[model samples]
Target: MQKRLANFDLDLALNVTESTLGILGGSGAGKSMLLRCLAGMESPSKGQIVLNGRVLFDAKSGINVPSRDRRIGFLVQNYALFPHMTVAKNIAFGLPKALSARQVRQRVEAQLAAVQLQGYGDRYPIQLSGGQQQRVALARALASEPELLLLDEPFSALDTHLRSQMEQEMVTRLRTFNGVSLFVTHNLEEAYRVCQDLLVLEQGHAVAYGAKYDIFERPGLLGVAQLTGCKNISAAAEIAAQTVLAGDWGLPLQVVDSIPDRLAYVGIRAHQIRFTEHANQCNTVPCWLVSTSETPHRMTVFLKFNTQPDHPQDYHVQAEVFKEKWEMLKQKPLPWFVQLDPLRLMLLEA
Candidate 1:
């Protein structure tokens, strides 16, 4: 399907089956837009949307199902709950009007139990905490017994501790759900923890899509590498079958994987850089410390290779080390050797 906005145009086709697919991307990357289109909240400019063999949308045939009839549960960002309505009422609002009042009450109670917000249903949304409000919204979404669920940054408004707690709860909820789910978020760790598969979007385009491990381990494109938390990417050219020259770092790396013919970038995670005492280690680079940054439990050491001169951007690599290791390594002398493990190297296209 395709969606054309003023500055961004989303053009992509995807098929999802039974598993939860995480939509991962930065802000304005069309992550939310994709969920909106799938939920029938927005019409696609082209192509067709078929869910459970039902044609929800077909641009060529001029068929567009209304959002109400799509049977999609949408837990939007900020938990779009009715402020004046009680939790039970908010959940019951989504139930079919054909059902009797007693049936609506029963369904609402069941949804409340599913989200672990049973007795709290009598309270208004304003009286609940962020996490509780989120639970209420989830209950409302599932009240209609949707065939698909779309979650858009559902934990964006919660505190760190609460977010983590709710994430575990959400995992349990999704496990019991008998339908496919689409989770949209910019946070990589959250996506990794909650979804089995991933679809990475960049500038409204799907740069990569696959199993979570495969996407993280072998992100094939530069945009996907960045999204997967590859920090030390450099312009590269294939020098040999298994080697590539990392241009920005002025280092040639021997990678475990074959160098792609159209190689445009090489990357390694900051934590993958290993500090070693041996000078002759494979892929070792002797470097001088440029700076050290300390986080609560870790340290970021910036180093420049001996071959690189002292320029403003001469720091060739940033290595993340534990605080204990940093304390031990700081005791050593200058010209420390760091090894770039070939096994963890990421080769990418333009």
Candidate 2:
């Protein structure tokens, strides 16, 4: 819908169609409201919802189709299966009565097999595991053969191991279906795994949206950096052309680009923060060892800084480190250096 949510401080000038459009957000980010609007359960104060070049909700045209006639598949969080019905019957429940009993049975069989539960059709909801029940839910939603499938946290009910398994399963099954899928998930790793593109929402607003790499590599705000787990983040002050970032790590960073003299938020990824004992000079700030941890893949050392060191004034620092170089730091407990990687650190514009 073009500008659907004008009320409640929501001003989404969004575009959509039968394509799978994920209304992703934390709870109360207007995701359900958008879903409701699309399904015609609720109407927008202003805007037009277009589907396949057809207007479903047009305030100007005074057209608001009812939910059932909208032809959409919405699989909600609860999996909403009827306790009494068998999995097969649940899947075929939405099918037209005019279909021959044999046809319905055939479709149900195919759906159960497609969801990798070919023989589970005879079982009731209580008999299936949480993951199995969700598979049936997905099959039921897909059975209707809608233009789009909206899955709201489809894997939430499953445990970590099962969730990962179901993630792969969803990808395989969704590929067979021609329509787009709007799958909601809070797992950052899962989000990175499933989506080629991304839309990050914060406090009822789309704070960032782009390719996954861009959002991770170049975060837009402090919130986004934190959301994506870009570990080192702190406040900095700009001194004319050079921006000075200083924080717990005692490192002072100079802004590579010219920003007006003011305070700004500084962020750098853990992997990007380099620890080099290259020099006892301005850009290299000293950090005292707190403790260190070593794992098979990489080493993580904790350090603290006493005061803000002198700098051309660029960035703030305090983060975990990886690679073999980190191995050397774990042996000692004293002063060290954190050489901020000039290229990778970010200065959020205030």
Candidate 3:
């Protein structure tokens, strides 16, 4: 399907079974647009959508199923619960009206139990905590037993502590969901935690889509590397079958994997950089400390090569050191050696 946003164009062709796929991208990347199309809230400009052998949309065939008829569950970021409805009523809203009152009550009760909110059914949305409200949204989404489930940044509104809790809650629910699922998020860590497969969108394009580990570890595309939280990336030229010159960081990287021809970049996660006392390691480079920023558990150290201080812009590297290691490094002098592990080095095609 194709969607044209103000400044972005989204053209994606995706097919999956009963598995969870995380749609990851920054703002304006069309992640939510894709979900909306699948849910029948937005009609595609062209092409078709078939789910579980049912044609949800077929522009050429002049077929367009209504959102309610499509049986697709969508959990919005803000929970989207009705303030006037109790949790049971909200969940029952998704059930088909053909069901008898007793059947609707049973379905709502089962959904509430599935989300671990058995007795909270009569409680209004405002009476529940943030996490409870989120669970209610999940219960409502699953109440219809949808053929496809779409989650659009469902945890984006929660506090950090609550987000963690809801993430695990969603994980538990997904374990037995029995439907195709797609989760859209801009947060790479959350995507990694929830999805088995990942689809990376950039400016309306599917930059990369594959198993989560392959997509995260060997992102192949420069945009994918940046989106997957790679802090250190440098323009590079292939030096040999297993070597490349990192032009920006002023270092020659020797990777264990074979280097491809026409390589354009090299990427290393900040945490993959190891502190080294010896400067002669295979991928080691002598670096002088530039600055440091500390988080609760780790320190992000900015370093420049002792050899090319003049090219500071290009030679700057970021290395993540644990708080304990950072404290020890602070006791030392200005110069230190850092090693980029060959196994962790990513050779990219840009």
Please estimate how well model 2 matches the true structure, expressed as its whole-model Cα lDDT. 0.70
Candidate 2 — which residues are off by over 4 angstroms?
1-7, 16-24, 96-98, 240-243, 247-250, 255-263, 277-284, 291-302, 306-318, 321-329
Off by over 4 Å in 1: 307-313
Estimate, for each residue in 259-340, the C-alpha lDDT of model 3 and write its tens digit.
8776799999999889989888888878877667889999998889765355435448898889988889889875788888
TM-score of each: 0.96, 0.81, 0.95
Q: Is candidate 1 or 2 superior in TM-score? A: 1
Clashes of each: 0, 6, 0
The CA-based lDDT of model 1 is what?
0.90
Q: How high a TM-score does candidate 2 get?
A: 0.81
lDDT for each residue of candidate 1 in 272-299, tens digit (9 for 90 to 100) = 9999988888799898888888899999
- Which candidate do you rate higher for lDDT, 1 or 3? 1
RMSD of 2: 4.8
Task: Please write out the lDDT profile of model 2 over residues 18-82, one tens digit for every residue.
Answer: 33333445656666666666767778777787766767788888998876666677788889999
Pick the lDDT winner.
1
Q: State the TM-score for model 1.
A: 0.96
- Candidate 1 differs from the real structure by a C-alpha RMSD in angstroms, to one decimal, of 1.6
